[model samples]
Target: MNRNTFVPVNEPLLKGNEEKYLLECIRTGWISSEGPFIKQFEEQLAARVGRKYGVAVSNGSVALDASVAALGIGAGDEVILPAFTIISCAAAIVRSGAVPVVVDCDPVTWNMDVAQVEARITPRTKAIMVVHIFGLPVDMKPMLALAHRYGLKVIEDAAEMHGQTYAGKPCGSFGDISTFSFYPNKHITTGEGGMIMTDDPALAEKCRSLRNLCFKPEQRFVHDELGWNFRMTNMQAALGVAQLEQLDKFVQIKRRMGARYTSLLAGIPGIQLPLPRTDFADNIYWVYGLVLADSVPFDAKEAMTRLAKLGIGTRPYFWPMHEQPVFRKMGLFAGESYPVAERIARRGFYVPSGLALTDGQMEQVAEAMRKVFQ
Candidate 1:
């Protein structure tokens, strides 16, 4: 490895028709929220995920917020979800004046523990927000069963699992409402954008209204309800359309990259490689992560620091939300413990798994690990 060179954790691939579509928007002056590209991107992406309608939003966090709002999840409603996930999920629940009931993840898949989900349900529980983490679908069958049995809405956070499926169905297909993010690090990106999708037309319209500041279509500047400005721009949707066109190719590339990393790092001592395949399918390594085994004297933070010194970039897993200071200050999840999540958060993190990453870089990264262990 060159001492002067740094290998980043992720680099988004954008070698499609992004420029062509983007230029069209520029020429036509269709740069704002209402444009053909927005609807086209929304419809195309929604169909790909087997949903009837898609509403473009400003960002992923608001996608979640719009979903919560569309479902009428408010004041005194309780939403159950995994503790080991991005803060956007919990924040959406909190913002809607709903309580987020946190649960641990399965030790193997690192998705939510479906078994634990049932236990968290109560008379006030109104929804289950399932986040398909690290590009793997949560085992949705059980989650769906519980949702049906309890009459609770299911919101699929398919932001990470684009082009991924569960039991031969789309990741976004099972939930009543689903959301996706187009952040640069995702499988596909619009620089910064998001979408909310659903089979229910009413929910879809409600999400659209919430995304657009609740403007009454019949009159201008007349509103009955408060809403945020979460409308995605036409330029972003143009980029998204281009990205979506190449999403299948990107998924294949990601799997290839993940397999190469697994093969190279197989049986590395003191660190446990991410499972090559899970019960669902080949573990699509969003970032090629390694968990320091209990036998190791050091933790993931120390390992990351060592790798950084070697000019290799890495990112740690999400710290369990139940342990967050902000949530604690709010008196939420007080004294709650999710042991599996806590363990992985301390030991797990990913190396370079970017679509733009090369095989040669993986070799260097694996070699750097050998040096770190020594």
Candidate 2:
């Protein structure tokens, strides 16, 4: 591989449409958060997710925070979430002035362990934030049942699962509030943008107000409650609208690349490939992940470093949030053991799987992995 030609772990799938939409926004002088693109993008996303409303925001983290706030989750509340996820999940809870109860992930799906979730629910438990990590949907049937039993709100972090489905229902449609990220590396890109989807009209209004510093209609200059300036710009929304138009096509490419990776890596010893769910038909893979079995000579970090040396960029699975220094110091987590999350963090790594990657590049990645493991 030439040093000049770098195969990134993931890349944005942008075309001329994105540039054209942005230029239109600039020409219309609607470059700020308030513009036609914002409403159009929100409506289009809501329709895609089978939801009634969608509120665009600055980014996914703020979307999560706004969702929590919209649902009246605040001090002394506990939000259950998988420990094996991006740090933003826990951070969002903390930022909302609530305690995050970190649960272990299911070994099979690497999503929040439903069994652990039941055991973790307390009187203070206000909600459950399910992160569909790497585009694999959590078994929502059982999770939703549990939430209903306990009267806890459900927030779906569909950041990595733009077009995925669970039990025939869309990934973002199940929860009380669902959040998505539009970072460059996600299934879609808007430079930096996010959205909150909900069927409840009241919650939708609250989200809109919260994202704009909780402005009041009665008093023009008066603030009803404390909120942040977490608003998405029209420029970003314009890009998002354009990207949303190509989402299905991009998802198709991702599915094809993921299948190719599995076909090439499945039979390799010491490699445990990601398993597709039988019940779910649509899985928009954000990354092609694999785990090193216990018998493997090296851990995830070692394998990633070796692959990197071969010009194949790879990434380790997320570190369990309960063990992170900040969360541990806060004394938020109760249980001492989260074996599944810890083990996955140590053994798992992901190869490049992006719409931007060619089949030939995937072959190169697979060949590099074979060389490392052989």
Candidate 3:
């Protein structure tokens, strides 16, 4: 093995019509938010996800913020979410003047424990924020049932789940308002962008209004409500349009990468690989993660340090929301403990699993892992 060969944690593949669309944008001077690619990208993504409308936003985080506000969930409302997800989930709720009620995740899937959600629900619970963690979809059948029974809204965060499905239904199709991210590391990259999907025309309109500063169509300068300037630029949409065209191919490549890594790293001691498939959906290998066994002498930070010295890039798992200092200082999740989330946060980290990763690079990563654990 070449000790100097470096493998990054993720890299975007842009072999499609990205250049053509971007050049078109430049040629036509449709470079701002008013470009044609914006609508084209939004409509195409909405159709692919089985939704009636899509609102392109600046990025995924604001997409959540817009979705929360559009749903009319504000002060005194409670949104149930997982403790194992990114801070963006809780941040949106907190920013909206709503309380985020968190539930523990399943140890195996690392998705919100649907079983635990029911126990945490109170009279103020207004919505269930279902985030599809990693590549696996949260068991949505039961989640949908719970939402139906409780009369609570569902906000699906399918940020890492492009072209993935749950129980044969599209992931973005499950929630009343679903959101997606097009960050460079996602299955499809648009540099930095996001989309909000919904079947209700009214909700779709609200998302659009919210993203563009709540400007009235009839009177551009007049604003009746406060909203953020979260519109996705035409240049970003050009990338999205081209990238969306290659989604099916990208998904296939991701699954193959995951399969190859699993085959290569299969019996390595002291590490737990991702569950390849759930009952409802196969793992998309958004990023190939590994959790150290309890017997391992070191935690994920040390593991990452070792891998970095070996010229392999890795990233630690999300720190559980309850343990975050910002939340603690805000008097949230006081005295809470989620053992599974805590353990994973300390023990889990993902290796190189980019769309642009070659088979040879993956083999090198596997060799690096062998060296690290030996």
Instruction: List the global CA lDDT of all models.
Output: 0.88, 0.87, 0.94
Q: What is the lDDT of residue 84 in candidate 3?
A: 97
| Ranked candidates (lDDT, high to low) | 3, 1, 2
Candidate 2 lDDT over 1-374, as tens digits, reads 77545578887788749989988988999999888999999999999999999999999988988998899888999999998999988898898799888888888778887788998899999999999988688888889999999999999999988878887788899879999999888888888889999999999999999998888977766896988899999999999988989988988888888788888876678988877655765556788888889999789999998988889888889998978888777876645778999999999989987679988888888888899998
Highest TM-score scorer: 3
The better candidate by lDDT, 2 or 3, is 3
Write model 1 residue lDDT over 286-360, tens digit each, in one string. Answer: 666677888999899999999999889999999998998999999999889999999999999889888899877
RMSD of each: 1.4, 1.5, 1.3
lDDT assessment of candidate 2:
0.87
| Winner of 1 and 2 under lDDT | 1
lDDT score for residue 331 of model 3: 99
TM-score of each: 0.97, 0.96, 0.98
Pairs in clash, predicted candidate 1: none
Candidate 1 ranges with C-alpha deviation above 4 Å:
1-4
